[model samples]
Target: MAATGSRMGVVGGSIAGCAAAVAGIRAGAEVTVYERSDGELRGRGLGIVIPPPLHRRLVGTGYLDAAMPTAPVATRVWLTRVPGERSAREFARQPSAVTPCNWGLLWQSLRSAASGARHHRGLPVLSVGHDGDGGALVRTAGGEESYDIVVGADGHGSLTRRVLAPDLRASPAGYAVWRGTLPVDASAEHLGALQLLRTSWVTIGFPGGHGIFYLIPRGGDAGPDERLLAYAIYATPPEDAPDGAGHVRWLADEHFPQEWADIVARGEHAAMTCHPVVDLHAPVAADPPFLLAGDAAGVTRPHTASGAVKALQDALCLEEALRTSPTPAGALRRYARERTPEGARLVELGRRLGRAQVELTPDWAAMDQGSVDAWCRATLAGTSSYLYADTD
Candidate 1:
């Protein structure tokens, strides 16, 4: 089991860090979070789909509002190409039971729930090493501190991972994603409650790859108004970084065909953000007393949009191992073994999906449809398993 009467230090203050702190606290360990940022972390992004089982647990634990305003259930995912290309249409219809929510809203709820935890903001970790006996030492901007256990909840570029698992490298998955949220005006035809609530859309350009757009409802009780959030991720190679002119310009000038220029033009210049699609193979265990969790251990491409899900899974699995194992080192080992399979599977799936989107000239229709079906089935199964594991 986790060493009793021990203090735990969590590095990084995002979702994974916060969740780890909470779990550690609940397991009867004193926990402290060392955050690199001095203030709150905020960003606008696409909505996140929360599995019903996980959502129920968050509600029961008071981490989410019992009756918070949420977007309509996502019953259909429409896939199409730009410029009304009839030959490029594809669709995946999900059961009417699934629900989706804004990613920002979920973060807000998690942040609020972690208000009571001890947080040291603006204190970036400089180094982490053993204290020569059983405890670990973490050097931060402020000073050095020791703890019985150290948790690396930092993101993909984790400092702890660098110190511990130096060989675990993130390889670019050959494609880059440009994502942004656009405002929906009142007169917009696609802004109906049912459409906005339950229908998620993905438009894949023929030969050029895919673009996904979805609507997420924000604000409680007041209901979604003039501001409906729309986000899209377009595929591009890693070496093709767009300049300040905007993604639309980059697409029109460098990548996209003339027919898709108008669709690219719809995005606002200031809203576009670029990110490389990257994931790491599961790392070998580096140390016995320290452990990796969340993206620090491994990452899933945004194509699956399961980065958050995998991080949450790491937290839950680590919590279980820590609670049940006979020793602290044993718990860490078990955590790694339990998590490696799922992490590797997600990595493989993400890369395959990304590859399918980027590779052109290979029977696009058959390839695209097959990918969508496989994704839907895999997502549903993963969600069910995650929810069951979390609640069990």
Candidate 2:
């Protein structure tokens, strides 16, 4: 694969798409990025964390900046309610090292890093194919174009994945995540609890659900006091749970912590977002010049805490493959071969964790410290480690 004069097209202009563009350029390819969104992507998303190990890897590889604004997490406290308990009881507390990130900021950094490439905004790729000579043909609403290589960084509904692996689809995991963010002032009444969680990420576990909440840097150019209370509540929706924000409120009221409930009750109509949990993986990753990256290749459960890490890693690996392989075909296949197993493992780990934490939960009231540890070990048997160490 000669680096010079190679043309590469990257679908999707979000985080993974931008990273793919960067990879293509670093490999000496002329790159073009196609983003479906018309306007500038606003920094809007719940808290996203990059584990310390993955953080170091990404920063070392120039995919992430060391100085990115992040809230350093010092502890993970798991709380549950028992029959006689007046308040949430903490049965497990572990020293946790995690860095919480605002998703929009991360995307902005990746896009800036890939500034060398030409980005085509407001264009959505409709389909993809091969040019019969190890080249890729991409069809968008505007027109069709050919490139030496095509990367599907488009999210779950990837056109490249549909062409490459039509059978692969994201399946609902029988649960949902009701997520939202609240300003620090919105949670002023819980100042004491907020102080306790200054350096801690708290997880409140119930019979069939759990909520993880932590402080995150506010989006955009936020001041020092500007912080957000990010909460993700996972639960099985009730029969009458209305769609959209109503469902978010229903789930939050039923399962989330009281602090989260209070924030939701503040009458911020657009505060919450509801998303159905889905897991999917494509059996094959690459077919010559056309390849899949990020969620297009496989979407692991957020429980693995490797969604963003895996996406960035995919682009980084693709960059290495292109730089080292003798042929473009070889590079694409090598990237796929190396990443498929890691994707499968993370998806499986997510399913396992989801089952343990949501579907088939343990009786929290009856578990002791040793029991909790044992349960975690048993449920996370194949997940490598709590911090996603094995994948690295």
Candidate 3:
């Protein structure tokens, strides 16, 4: 294996970093991880969804635990609020299968599997670059270290990504996404919405943008109390809008269905936050002693829902490349060749999806399965995605 007996430095200890560490170890490399945050990053984010096949592949490959709790959704229901209507109008339904996971739980699973790596917490990488002799160097507040190869899983503002694609920066999408998780309530009033979540994921459309709602396992348990109602609501936040839950409540109360709005606006969540949507794809995935993965390689709009999926695939592909290549350079070359184009494709797909779903503002109320299929065809523009590839 190309990575056999080699020293691998993986920057960042989140999902991408942990997964990269697992890849390095399995490829016979000695791995070390640098995490900037000293505290547990596990419970920070709310929800993540990936294709069922990809989830299965990660589990089979040992990147995730087999018994990890996940809520698998089979169909996506599109709804739009009708004025003076108590219930939202279900305009379209499609076979959109995915496994929804709590971000914390998923990261914990990966971190456990990658226990072989010496993980350094609260250590921030000051800079990373090629040593110019078929190796790389990572500098931190603690000290500097040299490695046969450095995997920059440090995310979008990565110091390592600058060494490869300094000019690359994420472009804003002129909107923002409000994300949070609500405690699932078993009250009789909310049973309808809760039942809908158990059945399928729902997309509620408004004028400027839309919202996605589903359930994700809270911690590692089952039952209504163990389930959390995770949501991502997108829209152009009006100028001078309130911050935090205030903005979320304003958006929900203004655009979402009554019951749906109540769910997102009802809870006091520690994870409630908002961020502007942006995207970027590195021009190259690797260049010899330096390689990129996850957000370090690219940041697609959340509409694509491929952020974590792309990262897991990166680690899987890296391990495969290193296992087969005769040298580290050869492995990096193969990794770059396969992932660069894929990153570009996902970025392009994300832009198209953003335009169709958010900017262009589709007529959700008028859409049925037929128009929805047509819209999907036009939006996808011949691009391939697991979400639509298997639909009838």
- lDDT leader: 3
lDDT, candidate 2, at 357: 88
**Which residue pairs collide, candidate 1?**
1-325, 1-326, 1-327, 72-197, 73-198
User: Per-residue alpha-carbon lDDT of model 1 for 169-263, expressed as tens digits?
Assistant: 89976666766555554324433322433454444444565665555565434464323454555555434444233654455434333323333
Give the TM-score comparing model 3 with the true structure, all chains together: 0.96
Cα lDDT tens digits, model 3, 1-392, are: 78999999999999899999999999999999999999988777889999999999989988899888888989888888986674788888888898999999999999999999999999999988767677998999887899998999999898889989888888988888988876676323677778888889998988878899888987745552367888888877767863455876877787778888777766656467788888888999999888899999999888888999999999999999999999988999999999999999999998998898889988677778788888889889888887776443
CA lDDT of each candidate? Answer: 0.62, 0.78, 0.87
Which residue pairs in model 2 clash with each other?
A: 1-326
True lDDT of residue 69, candidate 3: 87
How far in Å is the alpha carbon of 49 misplaced in model 3?
Answer: 0.3
Q: Judging by TM-score, tell me the better candidate of 1 and 3.
A: 3
* TM-score per candidate, chains pooled: 0.81, 0.92, 0.96
RMSD of 3: 1.8
Per-residue lDDT tens digits of candidate 2, residues 1-392? 55456898999988778888888888888999998888877555677877776778777877777667777777887776545433556788766678788787788778888999999999888888888776889888888899988989898889888878887779999888877887777678976558856878887787787878887778677863467888777777766763466665655565445654556556343256877888999887777788888888888877766777788888888899999988777888898899888888888988988998899888877776677667777887755754533222
Candidate 3 stretches greater than 4 Å from native: 186-188, 220-225, 242-244
